[model samples]
Target: MSKSNFIKVIVAGFLITSIVGCGTKNFKKTPLDNYIVENSNEKQFSVILEDMDVDGTFFKTYSHKYRVIKHKEDDTPYEQISDWIEVDKKFFAKHEDNLGMVILEKKGQGKISKVASPPGYGYVGDSRYGEWRTHNGSTFWGFYGRYMFMNQMFGMINRPIYRNDYDTYRGGGYYGSRNYYGPKKGGSSRYGTNSQQTRKEKPNFFRRRASKSGWSSSRSRSGSRSRSTGFGK
Candidate 1:
């Protein structure tokens, strides 16, 4: 080969390698178990994954926003707190799809639970928090006077938790295992990273970084088992 042609080929290969390497990163996951164990003293509580952010630098790291929810008693209002936990690329990838979902919950001195679900669903069929109601013959969830705060807190004011949506979520048995967002009928689900309601809760995370990373596009990818789980699937 001519020297000039050989030099051009070598340059092309070098550029391709650089592009690929730029996207590759090695990150050690900060185990979610650690987070759960940190708060095990609470009798009833939930740890929610609210948002995810990737830092822009030569070496990228991640920051995860979490909301820890607790209700001291059946009649009392829930107490909620939020904080940011910095994590690595590997841990980020595992939970990036679960933004605005519950990652851990313990009820009434029960064991720490790692089943994932959209927030406020545990109250759907329970009579303590709410009861079923009808609007022009259409059924929906109606929170009691004291539990009214959940309507907005759970993103149900605009989204409106219809009976069918909750039934489908439960019928699919997605309550404790798979991360569910509305339903998976008609070849699509009504809620997820794209839902306006979800977007409202998760902030403008994907919208701000849509073009650069295609984070939304890659959300369909399955996640690996949680580090906190030891039970067989």
Candidate 2:
């Protein structure tokens, strides 16, 4: 083959490979849109917490009890589990409005405690704030005496329904993940001996800085744990 032709073929191959394989950093799951139709009125969705007991000796998995139901219709939709995964304390400080709604957050190893409420009583005005209250005003999730382990499930219709605000608003929150990634429609702290309210109200150790359309990293350190309590409760 001619040298020019070989170079052109190689460039084309590289472009194709990049286009097909490139994916988001720190994430391994697919987008929710692929499974669920954004605004489909056909199916109903719900999320339940799988109760688990870790006796420090061995960990046994339990079925999820409460569920955050999205749609109540008979038909069931498909959605990504991660789309519903949320990290509470970390999420609220960055996106306060997201409170009372289900959302997802990313955390490093041992940082699973990322899901916690803002101290005592969970919510200030509404007890339902930190706890998961069903659409029917019933206890759904949250309120684990020890460590709470649960999963958020997303649902959508199979029809080719038009996408909604979530799908369009792609990473619109503190986590910089897809806006629809969490509760779409709706949308931590160090430990200490201080009071729950006082501690939760305190500022987070890591502060987000201005971005310049590029990549960056952040780091912070603190001594205590359990300063705030939500999904981790």
Best by lDDT: 1
After superposition, the stretches of candidate 2 with alpha carbons farther than 4 Å from their true spots are: 1-3, 19-25, 30-42, 46-66, 70-99, 102-233
Each candidate structure's TM-score, on Cα atoms with residue i matched to residue i, is 0.68, 0.25
* lDDT (10s digit) by residue, model 1, range 1-233: 99999999999999999887876653333546675566567666666776777645344546677766676555454645555566655567667667777777776537555767767776677687789999998899889998898887766777777888888787897755677777655654556554555666555776666645644332344332222322111
Question: What's each prediction's clash count?
Answer: 0, 18
**What is the Cα-based TM-score of model 1?**
0.68
lDDT per residue, candidate 2, 1-233, as tens digits? 99999999999999888777775442332122211333234333322222111111122111111223332243222232222232222222333322222232212211211232212111112232234434444333342332221222211111111223223332333223322222212112111112232223323311211221110110111111112111221
- For candidate 2, the per-residue lDDT at 27 reads 36
Estimate the Cα RMSD of every predicted model relative to the unseen true structure: 13.7, 16.7
With a 3 Å backbone cut-off (N, CA, C), the pairs that clash in candidate 1 are: none
